[model samples]
Target chain A: MTDRSRDGLRPSLDQPRRGFMPRFNIALVLPAQLTMMAVVIVPTLIILWLAITDWQPTQAIPWYDATPVWFWNFYDLWYDERFVNAVGRTLFVVGVCVALELGLALGLALLFLDEWPWRRVAVSIIILPMMIIPVDAANAFFMLFNERGPINHMISLVIGAPFEFSWLSHPTWAMAPIMMAEVWQWTPLMFLLVLTGLMNLPQNQVRAAIVLGASPVRIFFKVMLPLLAPVISIALLIRSIETFKIFDPVYILTRGQPGGSTETISMFMYNGAFVYFRMGYIAAAALLVLVVVISVCLVLARPMTKHS
Target chain B: MDRKLELRALRKSFGDVEAVKGIDLALNRGEFLSLLGPSGCGKSTTLSLIAGFLQPDAGEILVDGKVVNRVSPRKRRIGLVFQDYAVFSKLSVRANLSFGLEAQRVPRLERDRAVAEISEKLNLNPILAARGGELNMSEMQRVALARVLVTKPELLLLDEPMSNLDAALRAKLRGELKQIQKELEQTVLYVTHDQVEALSMSDRIAVMRDGEILQDDSTEAIYRRPAERFVAEFIGDPPINMVTCTVTAEGGVVSVSTALHRNLPLGQGEIAPGQYLLAVRPHHFQASREAAAGTVGSEIRLVENFGAEHVLHVSYGDDLVAVVVAPGFAREGERIHLALHAEQAHLFDLESGQVIALQRREAAA
Candidate 1:
């Protein structure tokens, strides 16, 4: 409450106000936001700062030199073919994974548009794989494709012999299994976002389409798909960014097998910074990756951005 | 833009509750017909059935003397203007107008020509480039009409087109709509729950209730000579007041009796010995200028003076009735007498509430 309206007399004796003033005591807002800044914002800023500075937890001093800067780190990343290969591998893996995931998600979203018997059971089963923890669970994929795992054993039983097919030794086949694992774990997220978009679509537009005498297929292509573009791009960007930084599935499932064929850029950065203690190079690499992510996102978001 | 439309015994039911029990009506070419009803009266369902969104349980819908029950809505070639003004939000006014033409695969040259003419007719020239959703309510409504009219449909269906507008815009559009229909000689089927909409603009009105067409006739016939008690009550403003009565046989005249007064002879409805009710419209029941000869007895309960008019709220044995009159009236705790114009009064059967048919001497002669 302000001092001007002390007695609940809203009409002031000396004022003819046309706009608003603070209705409540605003002193309470300051301390509350200060606490959030200390807890959340400060830590986020420190991490971003640490990505640019040459700081290491194992070092005797937080900064190895008086002025901690890494000019050589930025130029050195250009010569690292292994890191570039890792970045290329991450892009390829996430690209194929998000594409297949969106196709399955859109199919499920459309299938669930109309009510049918046992729809709840089918939808629950489709989203079940995503609910499990990815770390302890990426090993489940490891178990499924293991040489003596149940799947190969089951296949051997079907063939009436203990078949010996190389499951995880080939580079070309190595990324395929990793991509499949990523799709299984993340398709449910795309399904959920796309389903929300489909459900919230303006029903009046659909009814107008029907009254205009459009076939169901034409309606899907002309109306539903174009409208669903926002959902697709949003799902693509979020899942791809999340997938590009993917480390757990590749780490636990394939362990960067077939001579680092399945190693993503994040895992490579983790090894560079933590395992080999190359803080300057990893910091420079992380900043470059951030720029790439932002540029990719901006490119994907151009159509949905309103010009006005 | 004009074609004869007829629905033959069309019925629609949802799970056990029938929304449109059975509707049958014929619309001649170039006539404007209004389907009038209260909420939940199945007027919208009847329009949807005619629009081919809902399939009838049993019956045929004929457009231009051909049965088309199986035809899809797009294939039906009918124009519909919805209440919310369903012009495409993504399309400009001109694009919205051209949508129906493009749907029918009109040639590019012909479609553009049709849109240009419709845009001019609806006075949407300045708003040709504006998005449909960005327009105000009145302009949006004009665009909706323009979009439908550009197709040159066989019949035009407007479903409560003005219900969402302000009262002022509704009146203005009502006149403009009627004038346009007259100028084009377009066959129109309009639906509204408002009696004012029906009475002001429609040539013929069909009053519906509980999924059945209670009465269908010309607007004047429906209002002046309401076929049922519900029609008489529902058709007028503030509704007609009804009171139960007993009609006793007298010396060549049947005496109508109520609790407030007794033995008033209204020669219009024949008096049957059974139970009945007397319905008096508020306008028909008036405070006589001077106590001349004969008048029914009523005491004043209250009087309300609006700047231009006064309403008399009177009570007669738990029946609160009102009488609206011009300004310059004051009667409080002062005795007042009321009279009923017998020719204007209606007698209804007490049990069924149906209006009793009156026999005219001119017809007999």
Candidate 2:
């Protein structure tokens, strides 16, 4: 017996002419490349050009006709106390929210590792907050933190008196609700990723540790945590970047009102560009925020990449 | 005498499936015992029970003469080397070795000394600072063994630690492992499916099937005098050949008859005249061209050569029998007469698959 092929290639009566392969490849990728250039690169260049100019929307002059006051917008932003304060506030909020989310997520992930009744149902319910629309969640928090809301009623019941505190009106209290909203919306993501990482860990190592007379706590610290370092770093990096750009909750809850205490950099940029109509200044501020976020992500992602 | 580890009627069931069914085992101090079985035969499950990783459904696991059925794995003082060489990838070899010691609150000086000694003994000094994930397979295995040995637990359990190595590397590590165990005099309960490993390294072997121990005896006894049909077939490479036969009693002597041969006197045995299964190892059958008085004629179907020896597959009626012979014995399609060594042939009860007593003539007689 010999090897046989039923699905063999057949000779065609008319053969098509050969074409240039590289040119065809270029043509195939041209649409996506053009879309990317038009949507991302062109606007970024326009923003860069506007950031160095003293262009005013109130003036009827074309953008190119405006005088290029090189470094003047940046110079103004350098001394702008509100912008500096917004940057600091943004960093503080990002730090608090990311740290809290990571801690809570890790705890929840570890809790979910145990066998319990309705664990799958609980996990599905826990991730529901992440799936809710940010603006709707912000509105829900707005109603829940009102003076006559259930939260205050519960507090009143706990303290044996009628308690009413301005959650969104007070400057110091405003950021707390906004940070809570941020943590609530994103903590589920961290929990999911960290749980996956924990599940994928080498189970044999844990078993070996158990048989070697290491206590449960020692096994967690020595074997599990070190193995989970890369995953935690990645989760932290993603959460930090998202938290640094926090805007929707702050916009809905406080709108940087009652003082500008809860004003994050994104909120400041929005108010500057649309409310204050300082487009050039906001562009410069936005560029600085982007640079800071990118640098922070690079620093945080180093250990993650190394471990992986 | 107090045994190092013992299990009394150990039973574990997962829902409807009984993983380990009422097993009782004991290990003598400084003895190397191997639980030999195919996969899912509950050998590893038995190890896990003794290691306290799994609680038995009913029974007691005693370590050093004390019942530890309720003890946690960490407090049981037993060491287990996993099949995958579970070295912590995030820690260095030195750190991995010192983790248990640190957990036990061993002093830094003593921990260092013990680490150094085990590393030198296992020849892991060169890679002590290397990350566990970076070492090669052999190095990882050595580090895994050293880490467990350094702790010096009362009982050590190995679950096919050499299953993942190349053939040559496995052979080399087998010798090293035996040497290390001997030098340390560690009480080991090794689990493996490979008969060669069990026969070569273990002082005693326990053959398991379907969650029960069929035979537990010295390695030589398990190999030479298998207690059952499963033991006879499962222990040797190319396995033992079996032929259905009938035992007949005449004049207080017992003889066997098969389809190919009749009235063959089996020296002596207290076996009732009934159906039986005769088992003989491939190497015990002698094949020759000259037809002997009591030989069965067979036609060689194929020949498998193995450097120093060759296995001849011969056809007798509708049954194929294998005979292991030295090289240059017989060619394929050759007519040969086969004779069984009466001393090496084993008779098993057909109904129960249990070995029957057989008495053979003395060599002097």
Candidate 3:
């Protein structure tokens, strides 16, 4: 029997129209784009406008009338040594925190990735510090790390003398506490990511490596680490961005103390606008800080191209 | 030196289930054996035991007459090709081939030479630098084989190697694999649920069911002289046509009583006097255009064609049977008698399924 159809059944012209996409395709896309613009783009635009003008919530800069100050605030910041020190401190904190967090995160990720007896317990415990109360509650926890606390008492018992190291008092030692707080708060985040990456790794390759006679150290370094590059980069991106915006523990613990040792750029702006009430200067500094962060983030993000 | 590997009474139980039940088999040097069975029939588990991936509950797995029960898979040196052809996705084809060598800490130059040799053999030289995901399934399979073969193991355990290939490709690969195995002369224990693959590729096929080897024999022997009904039915595509018959032997000429009143001559194998099943292969009967002499059974149904093969469903008393006709032969619902060639027919014991002695049947007759 002869049949007129495309392939077996339907005629070519009678075939259902496939190229016409459903309305929900565009409907699903438009709202997401609009939401991103509303949440991300609008705020960035307002911050950009505030950077150029002498716009303050309390009062506008003098003789400007708030039309546009045209870099006067930035010029004012150019002479401010505290702003300069704040930049240095922010860099110092991000550098120390990122480095320590990465190392600890890698270690913890490795631990959790392994099939250990207390792996689940360690994971849940690591997650506890981040989940409890808030960032300010971190001070209550840090209070346990004090000279008069159980930590110092334990040190005294172990060493036969009470140890004294005022991390909150000394400038260099002060960043240690903030770095510790950041590490405590976010190491779990990196561990979870790296562990996920490790979990998805091809076990056959590892087995093949072992079968071929690669040592454990060689397999881990040459095989496992290279494959886990994507996840490591992702973790770095997230941790660096977050560590740049560090404000909570520094605010509660040091409060930019010991001559601005713990004064992150975020804290500097907070002090400028809220404590010092120099909103115009803070607004200008805020924009400058934003630029510096984006640029540094872009640079930190460069090595990650191997992943994708 | 040719060494024999033996799995002595190998038994493996997983929790409440016994996956491999007291299997005993030996693989001689350069022998290719196929474990043929249905799904969940313990063939893969047996392969795993040989690979040392799974520990057998109560058995000694001996490689070259030495027990390797406690050895890890990496130490066993039994190269396994999984059903999916599990290649390392992260590594290139060259790296995949050399990975096992790298693991062994083989020198770089030696490793490169080994990689070159295997890549040339597998025709994977062009794609040596191609990552696994970038290759097609067949290409990936070749890479996986190269990876396993590069190690030069004593045993190559293939677990349903071609189950994933399409029919045409399966045929091609099976032929290629047979040639390769013959050329390499490596002892291979292949597992497949596909009967065609088992029949075509194996030197001997162990038909498995319910965690036990039902029957094991040469492919041709399994086809012609099946030890059990499971073997008879499993070896054939349309399966052996089974029908009830009254078996009688007199003066060394055994006769089988079918739906027709005439008694037909039974094959040479000794039979006992009793009711029996007349097992006939589909292609054994000759089709006649008109009524043919010596034809016994009555026709019940017929199919004009099935792809390239035609089939006829016939009945004798309460027994239903099938007869496969050549392509372009027979019409639908045609009346025809299927004559049995007694010399080629089989008589199995009703209870034990054992082939009965014909002399005893003759004496009883």
Candidate 4:
């Protein structure tokens, strides 16, 4: 027993290691793990504590010292029309933007399938939008939709009258510019993904279909589309998630103005935390959004991984 | 004698290189014609041109004498089976088989019946619900065939369909495919580089070389009377043995004298005396264990085992020539006697590579 105790450290080191962490190189992942823990895990824990307490940063006390009001923030969120409207509006934006992006991308990708003299040049031009900074693209859109911008000038030229309609201040029409900007800026990425999938497809299958007398339309839907399912699903998942947190164009063009007609979930949280200084309520809303988005992504990813 | 498909001076070029030289070919209804050649021989290019997948630089393609060069592939109504057996991986076997029928807007009941018939014919019932990608290579081949056969196209084009199959599977599929073609009376244009496939399965063989069809004839005729040295060298299993010899034509009797044999009479023809090549198949050279009165003595250099027969590569005056013999007849390094059947041999011009024809008395009789 005395000898065993003396060799304890050596025996422990020789024992088969347990747990997944021991199998990995901790030094290689130390920086990433530490960053995630500091930025994400710590903030999440703090949010869990702050969610139950009506803590405002404007208060003359530390967040930990605030008095807790358990479940009140969630209760208030349930009846808040603005929060409910923002959630619905965000989903609507995601659906519209992702669908539009997919449809436009698919159409554009089909044109580049066959080789031509200037095909590479055309492809480079088409993907140019994706290379620009998102903030710059949003600013460009804001100016394009301005009251006295070239858009109105073109409309005036077509209609033979001055057509300076204020697109941002309009209640219902303001959402158009934001969605268009999102679609225009990101459709190129979706196009490239879909084009890659199309290019790598089994070429003989298409020729076989051609010899089988399948019409072009029939070939596209039945043969090519099914082959593109995995790529399309991945594109949809990524674009939908990115569109759900849309905020840059909204901030640049309208900032959720015109009676808050276009406030998405991210914009709602930003206003609650930074503008209105409701840190506790925003923390609760953020948690809810995070849970919903994660679950939705999981459900969407299940069938894709299974097929692949 | 209905001409089901025909290509008139079909030509195709890829930049500076011509893939398919101006070539003319025709397939009768219900006939199985094989385009046999080595790789880069433009046999596949001809198939593609006929299928409308590729446009010929200058040529005419006709289905039942109706020019189809301007028609779209989908409208041409031709069926093609690719070398890889390109089965639709995402679809089930049944869906793949019925794809053409559905595309042609055949009613649901007719489509199902056609799919059932083809699947039953191809023995694909067990894997009907299986996905195309899930099936093995042979299964994919069957599905690819069934998918096109269900459409009942006027002409079917198969591009090296058996190249992906194993030897045993290939032998079995060859018999099966020939039987199916005969039973259905389906006109087929099969492409292959394998001479065995061409000889065993084809009713007619078109030997191609370097983007040109050298000979298009009945299988027996192509084997027995190859027009070019390339064709004779390509068609036989042991490959025709080529020997340089001197040809002399005198007294209306054309004969060749080689290093081993003297004055071996070929036939009667009008020809100038010059050096020529004497081509003879391995089977035409008779081998004996002991030297005979007319046989030339040689030593066996190598032995190739081919199950039923053994091919002996015997030394023939500083040259090695293959002679097929029964197994156990000879061993490597053993002394042997070989005699040439002169009438069975061919004579080719030294410069032209063209066969020098001779009218033999026995052949004429």
Among these predictions, the greatest TM-score belongs to 2
Docking class of 2: medium
Sort by TM-score, top down from the best:
2, 4, 3, 1
lDDT of 2 by residue, A1-308 (tens): 12223233543334433578568988999999999999999989988988887776877778777678889888888899999999999999988999999889989998998779999999999999999999999999998898798889999999999999989999788888899998999999999999999898998999888877888788888899999998889889888988888999999999988778889998998898889877777888888888888899999999866764
Q: Clashing residue pairs, candidate 1?
A: none
lDDT tens per residue, model 1, A1-308: 47757675787656555434443334658788889999978865654565556666566556434234546556667887887898888888878888999999988899998889998898899898889898866888888888778878899999998876567777777676677778998999999899989988766566665666556776676567766777778888899889988888788867677787777898888778777776656767887898888888888777768533
Cα lDDT for residue B38, model 2?
Answer: 96
Local accuracy of candidate 1 as per-residue lDDT tens digits, B307-359 = 67787877767887777777655475555677766557778887787877764
Isolated chain B TM-score per model: 0.92, 0.96, 0.91, 0.98
lDDT of 1: 0.79
Q: Give the C-alpha miss distance for residue A293 in model 3, angstroms.
A: 4.7
> Candidate 4: which pairs clash?
none
Model 1, runs deviating above 4 Å? A1-69, A88-100, A135-173, A221-237, A257-261, A291-308, B1-3, B65-67, B250-255, B259-262, B268-271, B296-311, B314-318, B329-336, B361-365
Better of 2 and 3 by TM-score: 2
> Comparing only chain A of model 4 with the true chain A, what is the TM-score?
0.91
Score every model by TM-score: 0.83, 0.92, 0.84, 0.91
- Tally clashing residue pairs in candidate 1: 0
For each candidate in the order shown, give its overall lDDT on alpha carbons: 0.79, 0.88, 0.78, 0.91
